[model samples]
Target: MSTSTARFTHLNPGFICENCQREVQPLKVGCRNHCPFCLHSKHVDRFPGDRDNPCQGLMEPIAYEFNGKKGLTLVFKCKECGGMGKNKAAHEDEVQADSYELILKLNKPKS
Candidate 1:
């Protein structure tokens, strides 16, 4: 689907992380896309919160980027389909924040 035509479904449901097996809570504001503890996500959406993707693969945290306006964003690669995606980090969430250490580890410069 085209970006303009793609549908966005805002569904924020708690789920267990497939990578870390951690019980994750729903986000208080935005959609809870990835696990806050492990920073891993599932390939479950064609668009944001759509939950229409059939890949159902575990997405591995590969890297991160810092934006002045958007703050920290994480990059993920699907283990099954090799598709890549990005998500905004939830480090500032009051209930369950994304791992700052893991975000730093992913953002570190390679020697």
Candidate 2:
């Protein structure tokens, strides 16, 4: 589908996470792309809100990059295709505490 059409068709639905087995709810503030519990995302969107990608891979959270303008963005690596994607962290996320802990652990400097 064209990018424009993709955006118009995009729907955020509550899903049972394939990786963590959690019943995730739709985002109250925005689109729900990732599991708020494990911070893992599916390889769905080719562009933000454009779920045109067909990889259907499990995306693992790899690292965190903080931008002054954007706050925090989580980096993800797809297990099946070895592709990477980054998504901005949400403020009203249900699993914010755990998410922050994971982000801190991943973002720590190497010794």
Of the candidates shown, which would achieve the greatest lDDT relative to the real structure? 1
Clashes of 1: 0
Per-residue error at 90 for model 2, in Å? 2.3
* lDDT by residue for model 2 (23-83), tens: 8877765676777778898998888776889998999988878788977778889999999
Any idea what lDDT model 1 has? 0.85
TM-score of 1: 0.86
Task: List the global CA lDDT of all models.
Answer: 0.85, 0.76
Model 1 alpha-carbon miss at residue 41, Å: 0.5
Candidate 1 lDDT over 1-111, as tens digits, reads 333554555567899999889899999977878998989999997775788999999999999877789777888899999998888889999999998998888854343
Cα-based lDDT at residue 58, candidate 2: 98
Residue 78's C-alpha lDDT in candidate 1? 95
Per-model root-mean-square deviation over C-alphas? 4.0, 3.8
